[model samples]
Target: MCYQLVERFSACRCLYFQHAVDPCEAYRQRGHSVQEKVVLVGYTCSRHSMRWSGNKARDSTLSDSGYSSIKG
Candidate 1:
């Protein structure tokens, strides 16, 4: 039996990558005969992935510096 490797997106389960094996003629005779070994990537596909907004504010405080004034 011949086996093929398939990589898919973890989130959407979309086809990301594939490695095909040189299957024998007997295997090709039957439709969809190649055995698929599915390997899920850690990240999602670009189309289904999330994007972070650059315009969002990091902090609401007026001071950007880490240190604050210590009043006695």
Candidate 2:
């Protein structure tokens, strides 16, 4: 029902532009649907988490506590 063009630049972030464009009711006319096409606007880390900075801190070795550290 609408055409959405997503735009974003971030090291770690997932955002959806709320501005929805009017879509042609017929897929043949428009060529794509929101459900069929996905627009991802962010970055994902190893744990499925967004990166907070452009340069992510290197993860250290993990211990039995499920944490990464240089000295564990």
lDDT of each: 0.63, 0.43
- Please estimate how well model 2 matches the true structure, expressed as its whole-model Cα lDDT: 0.43
Residue 59 of model 2: what lDDT?
Answer: 49
Summarize candidate 1's per-residue lDDT along 14-64 as a digit string, tens digits: 897788785766775656577888877645565655454696534322322
Give per-residue CA lDDT, model 2, range 1-72, as digits (tens).
Answer: 545565332333344344455566664554565542334444443443433556775543222223222375
Model 2: residues with Cα > 4 Å off, grouped in runs: 25-32, 35-72
Q: What root-mean-square deviation over C-alphas does model 1 reach?
A: 15.9
Residue 51, candidate 1: Cα error in Å is 6.8
User: For model 2, what is the error of residue 1's alpha carbon versus the real structure, in angstroms, after optimal superposition?
Assistant: 9.8
**Candidate 1 segments exceeding 4 Å error:** 22-32, 51-72
